[model samples]
Target: KISNEITQFTFPFDNDVWSIPVHRDNSYYESTYKKSPMSKTDTINTPATFETKDKLFVAIHEAALTDFASMTLLKAKGNQYKSDLVPWRDGVKVYAQTPFNTPWRTIIVGTKPGDLVTSTLMLNLNEPSKIEDTSWIEPSKYIGIWWGMHLETFTWGQGPKHGATTANTKRYIDFAAEHGLDGVLVEGWNVGWDGDWTADGSSFSFTKPYSDFDLDEITSYAKKKNVRLIGHHETAGAAKHYESQLEEAFKLYNSKGVNAVKTGYVNKYLDKKEWHDGQYGVRHYRKVVETAAKYKIMIDNHEPVKGTGLQRTYPNLMTQEGARGQEYNAWSNDGGNTPEYLNTILFTRMLAGPLDYTPGNFGFDYKLPQGAKVQTTLAAQLALYVVLFSPLQMASDLPENYVGKPEFKFIKEVPCIWADTKPLDSKIGGYNTIARKDWNSENWYLGAITNDEARD
Candidate 1:
């Protein structure tokens, strides 16, 4: 049985209405047609949208970073007592018994589109931080050994050009120390990279380092340099296996004084037939976050569940690569990301949470193995540190790229955490200008970006 006329709600709209749909299902696995309200063309039940005398704006929130709920918005036509009329419906179904709460349905009410940019509704909706001891959790700018592997100049698996070897890692640690950076992320340092990780179910051992990479030596060296080592766990989407090894892996990192980790779920777990955004995936990610918190380890997720406002609840959930990040420019066959890409996400995807976009690319004109090139300028790259909100920002290029470069100053100086933010100017898929005040120093930083067009 369906309920009739749950409530008749109306708001004055001048130009268009933007409505964001909330869903708990894994968005990455679901088809666009199923996930989007606009796809429900024939039915009166469209995604949440507002229509005024002018234009109509429909906004859809894609993918669930967390689980089991469904939400929708329906528009009411004229006053006809017909059974066909569908009233606005926004609800959720959870199989779990009592004492559970549904995720917040965020509706930002504002006069203009930019007004939505400035709203604090999402942060306000989330519960206060569950982390009591935050002394260990600090925002940082990091340099990592991961990029060269992506560039294929170095390999994760052994043989030649192995990126995570002890000697190479020390170079990055030295670079971080020289640059006043706080952390160093070393990926592919473990034993299992030699195999087909996706198929080799339980082959990866997180605690054990590869023959060439000495965990003890590197951790001690980083301590001498006053730099923290950010650990990496590439599960290759084998969540169950990763979970089994989680305790031992985190224990290893903690013992080494490595307080942060970057986890990757690059592919789907074949046996489970599950997507990254599905219920099982959601729970798997949550378990990782909660478990990491238990060990005082901060998490930076790559190819992760879409970040809902969970960071507010779990402060250790520092940042995530939930969108098309900077790496696409290096090896993507699609000719890298466009100028408009960042602007598009700033309003849409970024509304959910912080993104580890991995900004700081100085080699703008450099061509990759795939012949893809970064389209943005050096200035625009500098602006990204301010534009994208992530506590764990990265100076992604190799240390050699920053030598004597003026733009590197911005990357070095930008604060990783902000106390206050003001969305100065914004338009969906067009341009964005944001100003954020540093949390510790109270200094202000501003980042502005234009789409494909050149702007003054």
Candidate 2:
């Protein structure tokens, strides 16, 4: 499994340990496992393939240069990287195409006030076998929304959406299709969400929906409207039952034309070691990949596992929310992420795969009408369509919120998967730039960001 084409970076210090800042606001976009494509701008050069370690190293260096340059320009204008102020930003986050544990690790160093530090990172995947040359699906043409309109049907914090009538669900689906959406997600559609957490965990029934929601009718109607009905499975609480019932679930979903599903492992339960299958977040995730492949159904996992280039092995494994996502709205007031963290994550958490960070909640900014639920600005959300990579991307914000906003074009233009990806710059938690091109089209998509204070 020795890849002569892999890059290697030797630090001057011992044990390859280094610290970098991770801004909390950047956490707004949780890393998902989806990807979109962009036309090649030819703005930067890329290596066709890393044929040797030297080439890989060269690629990283080149990417680092580009990232630094972009951030440097931004910093000159007075934008300071926020991650430098945080203590936890200095840690190793791996995103490899194969399962690779870097032989090296580092202790992060805090940046001086008003300063930006760039850290180099190594990219490797544990399973090179998973890498695929074929495009899983065209990037950008198709867009999706996650967890469906359930939150609209019922308030997230107000307990169950018992009042989520079938009429309400249809109305939401109709909106997506009317507005040219490709798919809609429906989380919390099972019995567990409504007080049957125990028995329902093992009793996974793809054919069934909560008493109030008519899944079959909804999916059928969605198809007629040319919109997809994305199914969901919350399994961390009931792994054993889910494993046993998986085939049936897939078969039922297949029968119903459910091409996509969002699986989740939310809570950390005791004595349920098998739920994670005695593997770290990444290893257990491989099992899901294998299972989904058999059924030919695409999957988007949340709160359960981390990704490391498995999309190449299983194209259907669309996206995963490995990092803090919009769900932060329900939890804390930390605001979740910042520009510094956004720039750093690309080099660390997303180096190996597509992120389903569920971008696009335009309603959160403090500047919006008083009492609005959104937390960030419309421009930032627009940036995510470029910054976050995913084949199964989500327009997580409510349809009503986007009603007359023309900025929605950014989402319309973002590609979900790419034919090839080139890391233009690599600075683990400082600044990073990625250039990905659609396999079919000459067009390319480029995303670059930096930690606090920018780089040069």
Question: Which model scores highest in lDDT?
Answer: 1
The sequence of per-residue lDDT tens digits that candidate 2 reaches over residues 321-358 is 75656544433344446555565445345543567777
RMSD (CA, Å), each prediction? 5.8, 11.9
TM-score of 1: 0.84
lDDT of 2 at 252: 80
TM-score of 2: 0.65
**Top TM-score hit:** 1
* Window of ten residues with lowest summed lDDT in model 1: 79-88
- Scored by CA lDDT, what does every candidate get? 0.71, 0.49
Off by over 4 Å in 2: 1-165, 196-206, 269-271, 274-277, 280-284, 365-376, 420-435, 446-456
Worst 10 residues of 2 by lDDT: 66-75
Model 1 alpha-carbon miss at residue 375, Å: 1.2
Flag clash pairs in model 1: 26-277, 26-278
Give per-model TM-scores: 0.84, 0.65
- The CA-based lDDT of model 2 is what? 0.49
The lDDT of model 1 is 0.71
lDDT of 1 by residue, 111-181 (tens): 44455555566667777888898888889899999778767778888878889999999999999999899
